[model samples]
Target: MPSSPLLPSRPSLLDDLAHAALARACSAFRQSGSESFALPPVLVDATLGNGHDAAFLLSCAPPEALLLGTDIQPRAVHAATERLAAARQERPDCRVQIFCRGHQELPQIWAELPPEERQRPLLAGVFNLGWLPGGDKSCLTRAESTLAALDFLLERLMPQGCLSVHCYTGNAGGPEEEQAVLRRAAALPPRRWRVAYCRDANREDSGGRAESLVLMERLPISRREMRVAGLCQA
Candidate 1:
Protein backbone atom coordinates (compact mmCIF):
# COMPACT_ATOMS: atom_id res chain seq x y z
CA MET A 1 0.00 0.00 0.00
CA PRO A 2 1.09 3.58 -0.66
CA SER A 3 2.08 5.66 2.38
CA SER A 4 -0.46 8.23 3.52
CA PRO A 5 0.23 11.73 2.38
CA LEU A 6 1.22 14.29 5.02
CA LEU A 7 -1.44 16.84 6.17
CA PRO A 8 -3.91 15.44 3.62
CA SER A 9 -2.11 17.32 0.82
CA ARG A 10 -4.34 20.35 1.07
CA PRO A 11 -3.63 23.80 -0.22
CA SER A 12 -0.66 25.77 1.06
CA LEU A 13 -1.34 26.18 4.76
CA LEU A 14 1.19 28.97 5.12
CA ASP A 15 -0.39 30.95 2.30
CA ASP A 16 -3.85 30.41 3.72
CA LEU A 17 -2.67 31.59 7.12
CA ALA A 18 -1.16 34.72 5.61
CA HIS A 19 -4.33 35.44 3.66
CA ALA A 20 -6.39 35.21 6.84
CA ALA A 21 -4.09 37.69 8.50
CA LEU A 22 -4.62 40.15 5.65
CA ALA A 23 -8.37 39.65 5.77
CA ARG A 24 -8.40 40.39 9.47
CA ALA A 25 -6.50 43.59 8.87
CA CYS A 26 -9.06 44.62 6.27
CA SER A 27 -11.92 43.81 8.61
CA ALA A 28 -10.50 45.98 11.35
CA PHE A 29 -11.03 49.06 9.17
CA ARG A 30 -14.64 48.12 8.59
CA GLN A 31 -15.34 47.62 12.28
CA SER A 32 -13.75 50.90 13.34
CA GLY A 33 -16.42 52.99 11.54
CA SER A 34 -13.70 54.82 9.71
CA GLU A 35 -15.50 54.62 6.42
CA SER A 36 -16.67 58.21 6.31
CA PHE A 37 -14.14 59.67 3.96
CA ALA A 38 -13.99 62.49 1.41
CA LEU A 39 -11.47 60.43 -0.53
CA PRO A 40 -11.45 56.66 -0.58
CA PRO A 41 -9.18 54.94 1.94
CA VAL A 42 -5.50 54.57 1.01
CA LEU A 43 -3.53 51.32 0.93
CA VAL A 44 0.13 50.54 0.34
CA ASP A 45 1.40 47.36 -1.28
CA ALA A 46 5.02 48.01 -0.47
CA THR A 47 6.71 45.14 -2.29
CA LEU A 48 4.65 44.46 -5.37
CA GLY A 49 6.78 41.42 -6.50
CA ASN A 50 4.47 39.73 -9.01
CA GLY A 51 1.40 41.82 -7.96
CA HIS A 52 -0.54 39.03 -6.26
CA ASP A 53 -0.65 40.87 -2.94
CA ALA A 54 -1.51 44.09 -4.73
CA ALA A 55 -4.42 42.45 -6.49
CA PHE A 56 -5.75 40.99 -3.26
CA LEU A 57 -5.37 44.33 -1.52
CA LEU A 58 -7.29 46.10 -4.27
CA SER A 59 -10.08 43.61 -3.85
CA CYS A 60 -10.31 44.37 -0.15
CA ALA A 61 -9.99 48.13 -0.53
CA PRO A 62 -12.86 50.59 -0.59
CA PRO A 63 -14.06 51.81 -3.97
CA GLU A 64 -11.84 54.34 -5.73
CA ALA A 65 -9.17 53.79 -3.09
CA LEU A 66 -5.59 54.64 -3.95
CA LEU A 67 -3.16 51.72 -4.08
CA LEU A 68 0.57 52.40 -4.12
CA GLY A 69 2.87 49.65 -5.35
CA THR A 70 6.63 49.93 -5.02
CA ASP A 71 9.54 47.82 -6.21
CA ILE A 72 13.19 48.48 -6.92
CA GLN A 73 13.52 46.19 -9.91
CA PRO A 74 12.42 47.42 -13.33
CA ARG A 75 11.07 44.01 -14.27
CA ALA A 76 9.02 43.75 -11.11
CA VAL A 77 7.65 47.25 -11.60
CA HIS A 78 6.71 46.45 -15.17
CA ALA A 79 5.08 43.14 -14.31
CA ALA A 80 3.16 44.58 -11.38
CA THR A 81 2.00 47.49 -13.50
CA GLU A 82 0.65 45.10 -16.11
CA ARG A 83 -1.11 42.99 -13.51
CA LEU A 84 -2.62 46.05 -11.87
CA ALA A 85 -3.73 47.37 -15.24
CA ALA A 86 -5.65 44.18 -15.87
CA ALA A 87 -7.10 44.46 -12.38
CA ARG A 88 -8.15 48.03 -13.19
CA GLN A 89 -9.87 46.91 -16.39
CA GLU A 90 -12.01 44.65 -14.23
CA ARG A 91 -12.64 47.36 -11.60
CA PRO A 92 -12.32 50.67 -13.35
CA ASP A 93 -13.08 52.89 -10.37
CA CYS A 94 -9.96 52.26 -8.33
CA ARG A 95 -6.73 54.21 -8.96
CA VAL A 96 -3.22 52.77 -8.82
CA GLN A 97 0.20 54.30 -8.38
CA ILE A 98 3.13 52.20 -9.57
CA PHE A 99 6.66 53.19 -8.61
CA CYS A 100 10.07 51.81 -9.44
CA ARG A 101 11.35 53.26 -6.19
CA GLY A 102 12.80 51.22 -3.36
CA HIS A 103 10.38 50.07 -0.68
CA GLN A 104 12.23 52.28 1.77
CA GLU A 105 10.92 55.29 -0.19
CA LEU A 106 7.38 54.45 0.90
CA PRO A 107 7.53 56.87 3.80
CA GLN A 108 8.75 59.64 1.57
CA ILE A 109 6.06 59.05 -1.00
CA TRP A 110 3.39 58.95 1.69
CA ALA A 111 4.74 62.09 3.25
CA GLU A 112 4.39 63.98 -0.02
CA LEU A 113 0.73 63.10 -0.43
CA PRO A 114 -1.73 65.99 -0.34
CA PRO A 115 -2.74 67.07 3.15
CA GLU A 116 -6.30 65.96 2.49
CA GLU A 117 -5.23 62.50 1.41
CA ARG A 118 -3.06 62.18 4.50
CA GLN A 119 -6.05 63.04 6.61
CA ARG A 120 -7.98 60.09 5.20
CA PRO A 121 -7.84 56.74 6.95
CA LEU A 122 -5.21 54.29 5.79
CA LEU A 123 -6.89 50.92 5.48
CA ALA A 124 -3.87 48.63 5.28
CA GLY A 125 -0.24 48.36 4.27
CA VAL A 126 0.95 45.03 2.88
CA PHE A 127 4.51 43.86 2.32
CA ASN A 128 6.09 40.72 0.87
CA LEU A 129 9.75 40.76 1.86
CA GLY A 130 11.74 38.80 -0.65
CA TRP A 131 13.09 38.93 -4.19
CA LEU A 132 10.82 39.13 -7.19
CA PRO A 133 9.49 35.73 -8.23
CA GLY A 134 11.32 34.19 -11.26
CA GLY A 135 13.85 36.98 -11.18
CA ASP A 136 17.07 37.68 -9.29
CA LYS A 137 17.13 35.64 -6.07
CA SER A 138 19.97 37.54 -4.47
CA CYS A 139 18.21 40.91 -4.31
CA LEU A 140 16.31 40.44 -1.06
CA THR A 141 14.95 42.96 1.40
CA ARG A 142 17.43 44.15 4.03
CA ALA A 143 16.67 44.42 7.74
CA GLU A 144 17.67 48.07 8.07
CA SER A 145 15.51 49.48 5.28
CA THR A 146 12.62 47.14 5.99
CA LEU A 147 12.61 48.04 9.66
CA ALA A 148 12.81 51.74 8.89
CA ALA A 149 9.93 51.53 6.43
CA LEU A 150 7.83 49.58 8.93
CA ASP A 151 8.44 52.14 11.62
CA PHE A 152 7.53 55.00 9.33
CA LEU A 153 4.34 53.36 8.11
CA LEU A 154 3.18 52.18 11.54
CA GLU A 155 3.53 55.67 12.95
CA ARG A 156 0.94 56.85 10.40
CA LEU A 157 -1.53 54.01 10.78
CA MET A 158 -5.02 55.25 11.54
CA PRO A 159 -6.79 53.78 14.52
CA GLN A 160 -7.68 50.18 13.71
CA GLY A 161 -5.41 50.28 10.66
CA CYS A 162 -2.91 47.45 10.34
CA LEU A 163 0.33 46.53 8.59
CA SER A 164 0.74 42.96 7.34
CA VAL A 165 3.94 41.37 6.07
CA HIS A 166 4.68 37.94 4.63
CA CYS A 167 8.30 37.09 5.36
CA TYR A 168 9.85 34.27 3.36
CA THR A 169 12.81 32.84 5.23
CA GLY A 170 13.88 30.30 2.64
CA ASN A 171 16.55 32.32 0.91
CA ALA A 172 19.89 33.73 1.99
CA GLY A 173 19.57 36.68 4.43
CA GLY A 174 15.83 36.23 4.61
CA PRO A 175 15.79 34.66 8.08
CA GLU A 176 17.75 37.52 9.61
CA GLU A 177 15.35 40.05 8.10
CA GLU A 178 12.39 38.16 9.51
CA GLN A 179 14.02 38.04 12.93
CA ALA A 180 14.61 41.78 12.87
CA VAL A 181 10.99 42.36 11.96
CA LEU A 182 9.91 40.10 14.84
CA ARG A 183 12.09 42.03 17.25
CA ARG A 184 10.47 45.26 16.13
CA ALA A 185 7.02 43.77 16.57
CA ALA A 186 7.96 42.50 20.01
CA ALA A 187 9.01 45.95 21.12
CA LEU A 188 5.70 47.66 20.28
CA PRO A 189 3.67 48.74 23.32
CA PRO A 190 0.72 46.45 23.99
CA ARG A 191 -1.48 49.30 25.13
CA ARG A 192 -1.23 51.01 21.76
CA TRP A 193 -0.38 48.24 19.36
CA ARG A 194 -1.92 44.82 18.84
CA VAL A 195 0.27 42.34 16.97
CA ALA A 196 -0.38 38.83 15.66
CA TYR A 197 2.32 36.49 14.42
CA CYS A 198 1.82 33.11 12.76
CA ARG A 199 4.30 30.51 11.55
CA ASP A 200 3.89 26.91 10.35
CA ALA A 201 4.21 24.61 13.37
CA ASN A 202 5.57 21.80 11.18
CA ARG A 203 8.49 23.93 10.10
CA GLU A 204 9.28 25.51 13.47
CA ASP A 205 12.34 23.39 14.26
CA SER A 206 13.12 21.82 10.94
CA GLY A 207 15.58 24.55 9.94
CA GLY A 208 14.07 24.48 6.46
CA ARG A 209 12.28 26.96 4.28
CA ALA A 210 9.35 28.65 6.05
CA GLU A 211 7.07 31.64 5.75
CA SER A 212 5.64 33.77 8.55
CA LEU A 213 3.00 36.47 8.70
CA VAL A 214 2.87 39.44 11.02
CA LEU A 215 -0.01 41.84 11.56
CA MET A 216 0.33 44.97 13.63
CA GLU A 217 -2.65 47.11 14.53
CA ARG A 218 -2.55 50.52 16.09
CA LEU A 219 -5.18 50.50 18.76
CA PRO A 220 -7.57 53.37 19.26
CA ILE A 221 -6.79 54.53 22.74
CA SER A 222 -9.48 56.38 24.63
CA ARG A 223 -9.06 58.52 27.72
CA ARG A 224 -11.45 56.35 29.71
CA GLU A 225 -9.63 53.19 28.71
CA MET A 226 -6.28 54.70 29.62
CA ARG A 227 -7.59 55.74 33.01
CA VAL A 228 -8.95 52.25 33.65
CA ALA A 229 -5.62 50.71 32.79
CA GLY A 230 -3.86 53.21 35.06
CA LEU A 231 -6.22 52.41 37.91
CA CYS A 232 -5.69 48.71 37.42
CA GLN A 233 -1.91 49.28 37.54
CA ALA A 234 -2.30 51.25 40.71
Candidate 2:
Protein backbone atom coordinates (compact mmCIF):
# COMPACT_ATOMS: atom_id res chain seq x y z
CA MET A 1 0.00 0.00 0.00
CA PRO A 2 1.13 3.54 -0.79
CA SER A 3 2.07 5.72 2.19
CA SER A 4 -0.55 8.33 3.06
CA PRO A 5 0.46 11.97 2.98
CA LEU A 6 0.35 13.69 6.37
CA LEU A 7 -2.23 16.39 6.88
CA PRO A 8 -0.96 19.95 7.18
CA SER A 9 -0.38 21.07 10.76
CA ARG A 10 -3.07 23.24 12.19
CA PRO A 11 -2.27 26.93 12.53
CA SER A 12 -1.47 28.16 16.05
CA LEU A 13 -3.83 30.67 17.60
CA LEU A 14 -0.85 32.98 17.98
CA ASP A 15 0.14 32.65 14.34
CA ASP A 16 -1.83 35.77 13.54
CA LEU A 17 -0.73 38.81 15.48
CA ALA A 18 -4.28 40.06 15.97
CA HIS A 19 -5.51 36.71 17.23
CA ALA A 20 -2.58 36.61 19.62
CA ALA A 21 -3.98 39.67 21.37
CA LEU A 22 -7.36 38.00 21.75
CA ALA A 23 -5.73 34.92 23.23
CA ARG A 24 -3.82 37.01 25.74
CA ALA A 25 -6.94 38.94 26.69
CA CYS A 26 -8.88 35.74 27.25
CA SER A 27 -6.02 34.32 29.26
CA ALA A 28 -6.04 37.36 31.50
CA PHE A 29 -9.74 36.87 32.16
CA ARG A 30 -9.19 33.22 32.95
CA GLN A 31 -6.34 33.93 35.37
CA SER A 32 -8.20 36.76 37.13
CA GLY A 33 -8.94 36.36 40.82
CA SER A 34 -12.42 35.71 42.15
CA GLU A 35 -14.82 38.61 42.67
CA SER A 36 -17.38 39.14 45.42
CA PHE A 37 -20.36 39.98 43.23
CA ALA A 38 -23.37 37.69 43.37
CA LEU A 39 -23.75 37.76 39.61
CA PRO A 40 -21.24 36.49 37.11
CA PRO A 41 -18.65 39.06 36.03
CA VAL A 42 -19.20 41.23 32.91
CA LEU A 43 -17.02 41.50 29.81
CA VAL A 44 -17.20 44.36 27.34
CA ASP A 45 -16.13 44.43 23.71
CA ALA A 46 -15.78 48.12 22.95
CA THR A 47 -15.64 47.53 19.20
CA LEU A 48 -17.68 44.72 17.69
CA GLY A 49 -15.92 44.95 14.31
CA ASN A 50 -16.68 41.65 12.52
CA GLY A 51 -17.86 40.07 15.81
CA HIS A 52 -14.92 37.68 15.86
CA ASP A 53 -13.51 39.05 19.11
CA ALA A 54 -16.92 39.31 20.73
CA ALA A 55 -17.80 35.74 19.82
CA PHE A 56 -14.45 34.45 21.00
CA LEU A 57 -14.86 36.18 24.34
CA LEU A 58 -18.42 34.93 24.70
CA SER A 59 -17.36 31.36 24.06
CA CYS A 60 -14.80 31.57 26.88
CA ALA A 61 -16.87 33.58 29.37
CA PRO A 62 -18.34 32.07 32.52
CA PRO A 63 -21.80 30.59 31.98
CA GLU A 64 -23.63 33.51 33.57
CA ALA A 65 -21.34 36.29 32.51
CA LEU A 66 -22.74 39.02 30.27
CA LEU A 67 -20.90 39.91 27.05
CA LEU A 68 -21.64 43.42 25.83
CA GLY A 69 -20.62 44.70 22.40
CA THR A 70 -20.96 48.09 20.69
CA ASP A 71 -20.53 49.42 17.17
CA ILE A 72 -21.24 52.76 15.57
CA GLN A 73 -22.70 51.32 12.40
CA PRO A 74 -26.13 49.73 12.18
CA ARG A 75 -24.76 47.10 9.83
CA ALA A 76 -22.06 46.20 12.28
CA VAL A 77 -24.62 45.81 15.04
CA HIS A 78 -26.80 43.59 12.87
CA ALA A 79 -23.84 41.48 11.84
CA ALA A 80 -22.64 41.07 15.40
CA THR A 81 -26.12 40.20 16.59
CA GLU A 82 -26.40 37.51 13.95
CA ARG A 83 -23.00 36.09 14.81
CA LEU A 84 -23.79 36.07 18.52
CA ALA A 85 -27.16 34.45 17.97
CA ALA A 86 -25.50 31.64 16.07
CA ALA A 87 -22.98 31.27 18.88
CA ARG A 88 -25.79 31.10 21.45
CA GLN A 89 -27.41 28.21 19.61
CA GLU A 90 -24.35 26.13 20.38
CA ARG A 91 -23.65 27.69 23.77
CA PRO A 92 -27.21 28.14 24.99
CA ASP A 93 -26.13 29.34 28.39
CA CYS A 94 -24.23 32.40 27.11
CA ARG A 95 -25.73 35.89 27.41
CA VAL A 96 -24.90 38.62 24.90
CA GLN A 97 -26.09 42.19 24.34
CA ILE A 98 -25.05 44.38 21.43
CA PHE A 99 -25.65 48.10 20.90
CA CYS A 100 -25.56 50.33 17.84
CA ARG A 101 -23.53 53.13 19.31
CA GLY A 102 -20.07 54.59 19.23
CA HIS A 103 -17.42 53.39 21.67
CA GLN A 104 -17.58 56.70 23.57
CA GLU A 105 -21.20 55.88 24.49
CA LEU A 106 -19.90 53.33 26.96
CA PRO A 107 -20.20 55.86 29.77
CA GLN A 108 -23.87 56.26 29.00
CA ILE A 109 -24.34 52.53 29.09
CA TRP A 110 -22.62 52.42 32.47
CA ALA A 111 -24.98 55.08 33.73
CA GLU A 112 -27.99 53.19 32.45
CA LEU A 113 -27.06 49.98 34.19
CA PRO A 114 -29.37 49.13 37.07
CA PRO A 115 -28.01 49.12 40.61
CA GLU A 116 -27.58 45.37 40.53
CA GLU A 117 -26.00 45.41 37.11
CA ARG A 118 -23.66 48.19 38.10
CA GLN A 119 -22.59 46.15 41.08
CA ARG A 120 -21.43 43.26 38.90
CA PRO A 121 -17.66 42.99 38.68
CA LEU A 122 -16.16 43.91 35.28
CA LEU A 123 -13.79 41.13 34.20
CA ALA A 124 -12.39 42.31 30.89
CA GLY A 125 -12.78 44.98 28.21
CA VAL A 126 -11.48 44.59 24.62
CA PHE A 127 -10.79 47.20 21.92
CA ASN A 128 -9.89 46.48 18.31
CA LEU A 129 -9.04 49.99 17.16
CA GLY A 130 -9.19 51.25 13.56
CA TRP A 131 -11.92 51.03 10.95
CA LEU A 132 -14.33 48.11 11.18
CA PRO A 133 -13.04 45.21 9.14
CA GLY A 134 -14.63 45.01 5.64
CA GLY A 135 -16.56 48.23 6.25
CA ASP A 136 -16.09 51.88 5.26
CA LYS A 137 -12.45 52.61 5.85
CA SER A 138 -13.06 56.33 6.31
CA CYS A 139 -15.15 55.77 9.42
CA LEU A 140 -12.17 55.21 11.65
CA THR A 141 -12.20 55.40 15.42
CA ARG A 142 -11.30 58.85 16.69
CA ALA A 143 -8.65 59.36 19.32
CA GLU A 144 -10.96 61.48 21.46
CA SER A 145 -13.81 59.00 21.71
CA THR A 146 -11.55 56.02 22.12
CA LEU A 147 -9.76 57.75 24.97
CA ALA A 148 -13.02 58.64 26.68
CA ALA A 149 -14.31 55.08 26.45
CA LEU A 150 -11.03 53.68 27.71
CA ASP A 151 -11.11 55.96 30.73
CA PHE A 152 -14.63 54.86 31.53
CA LEU A 153 -13.65 51.20 31.25
CA LEU A 154 -10.63 51.60 33.50
CA GLU A 155 -12.80 53.26 36.11
CA ARG A 156 -15.19 50.30 36.24
CA LEU A 157 -12.68 47.46 35.94
CA MET A 158 -12.70 45.18 38.95
CA PRO A 159 -9.58 44.46 40.88
CA GLN A 160 -7.58 42.05 38.73
CA GLY A 161 -9.71 42.92 35.70
CA CYS A 162 -7.95 43.42 32.38
CA LEU A 163 -8.30 45.67 29.31
CA SER A 164 -6.77 44.73 25.96
CA VAL A 165 -6.48 47.03 22.93
CA HIS A 166 -5.23 45.97 19.47
CA CYS A 167 -4.20 48.99 17.46
CA TYR A 168 -3.43 48.87 13.75
CA THR A 169 -0.93 51.42 12.57
CA GLY A 170 -1.68 51.45 8.85
CA ASN A 171 -5.17 52.98 8.68
CA ALA A 172 -6.13 56.65 8.69
CA GLY A 173 -6.02 58.18 12.17
CA GLY A 174 -4.76 54.84 13.41
CA PRO A 175 -1.45 56.17 14.58
CA GLU A 176 -3.08 59.03 16.44
CA GLU A 177 -5.52 56.76 18.19
CA GLU A 178 -2.76 54.35 19.08
CA GLN A 179 -0.61 57.14 20.49
CA ALA A 180 -3.48 58.59 22.51
CA VAL A 181 -4.33 55.22 24.00
CA LEU A 182 -0.71 54.53 24.82
CA ARG A 183 -0.34 57.90 26.51
CA ARG A 184 -3.45 57.39 28.59
CA ALA A 185 -2.44 53.88 29.57
CA ALA A 186 1.02 55.10 30.52
CA ALA A 187 -0.42 57.94 32.61
CA LEU A 188 -2.59 55.55 34.61
CA PRO A 189 -1.31 55.51 38.18
CA PRO A 190 1.20 52.67 38.13
CA ARG A 191 0.20 51.76 41.66
CA ARG A 192 -3.31 50.95 40.50
CA TRP A 193 -2.75 49.72 36.92
CA ARG A 194 -0.21 47.43 35.35
CA VAL A 195 0.26 48.29 31.67
CA ALA A 196 2.02 46.21 29.03
CA TYR A 197 2.42 46.65 25.26
CA CYS A 198 3.34 43.79 22.93
CA ARG A 199 4.48 44.14 19.32
CA ASP A 200 5.47 41.52 16.75
CA ALA A 201 9.00 42.62 15.96
CA ASN A 202 9.24 40.41 12.92
CA ARG A 203 5.99 41.56 11.29
CA GLU A 204 5.42 44.73 9.28
CA ASP A 205 2.69 46.10 7.11
CA SER A 206 3.02 47.14 3.48
CA GLY A 207 4.26 50.50 4.72
CA GLY A 208 6.76 48.82 7.00
CA ARG A 209 4.70 49.77 10.07
CA ALA A 210 3.74 47.48 12.90
CA GLU A 211 0.65 47.01 15.10
CA SER A 212 0.58 46.66 18.86
CA LEU A 213 -1.51 45.23 21.63
CA VAL A 214 -1.81 47.05 24.93
CA LEU A 215 -2.97 45.24 28.07
CA MET A 216 -3.79 46.96 31.34
CA GLU A 217 -4.68 45.13 34.55
CA ARG A 218 -6.10 46.73 37.66
CA LEU A 219 -4.50 45.99 41.01
CA PRO A 220 -6.19 45.46 44.37
CA ILE A 221 -7.31 48.55 46.29
CA SER A 222 -5.16 47.70 49.29
CA ARG A 223 -2.09 47.44 47.12
CA ARG A 224 -2.83 50.72 45.40
CA GLU A 225 -3.41 52.50 48.70
CA MET A 226 -0.18 51.18 50.12
CA ARG A 227 1.78 52.40 47.10
CA VAL A 228 0.11 55.79 47.26
CA ALA A 229 0.97 56.18 50.92
CA GLY A 230 4.56 55.11 50.33
CA LEU A 231 4.90 57.68 47.53
CA CYS A 232 3.45 60.42 49.75
CA GLN A 233 5.82 59.60 52.57
CA ALA A 234 8.80 59.49 50.27
lDDT values for all models? 0.75, 0.74
lDDT of 2: 0.74
Q: Write the per-residue lDDT of candidate 1 for residues 38-138, one digit (tens) a residue.
A: 34678888888888778878777766777888888889988888777778877677788888888788778878878866655576888888888789988
TM-scores, each model vs. reference: 0.82, 0.79
Q: lDDT (0-100) at residue 119 of candidate 2?
A: 64
lDDT of 2 by residue, 165-208 (tens): 88877877777788899999999898878888877577675463
Q: How high a TM-score does candidate 1 get? A: 0.82
Highest TM-score, which number? Answer: 1
Candidate 2 regions with alpha-carbon error over 4 angstroms: 1-36, 202-209, 220-234
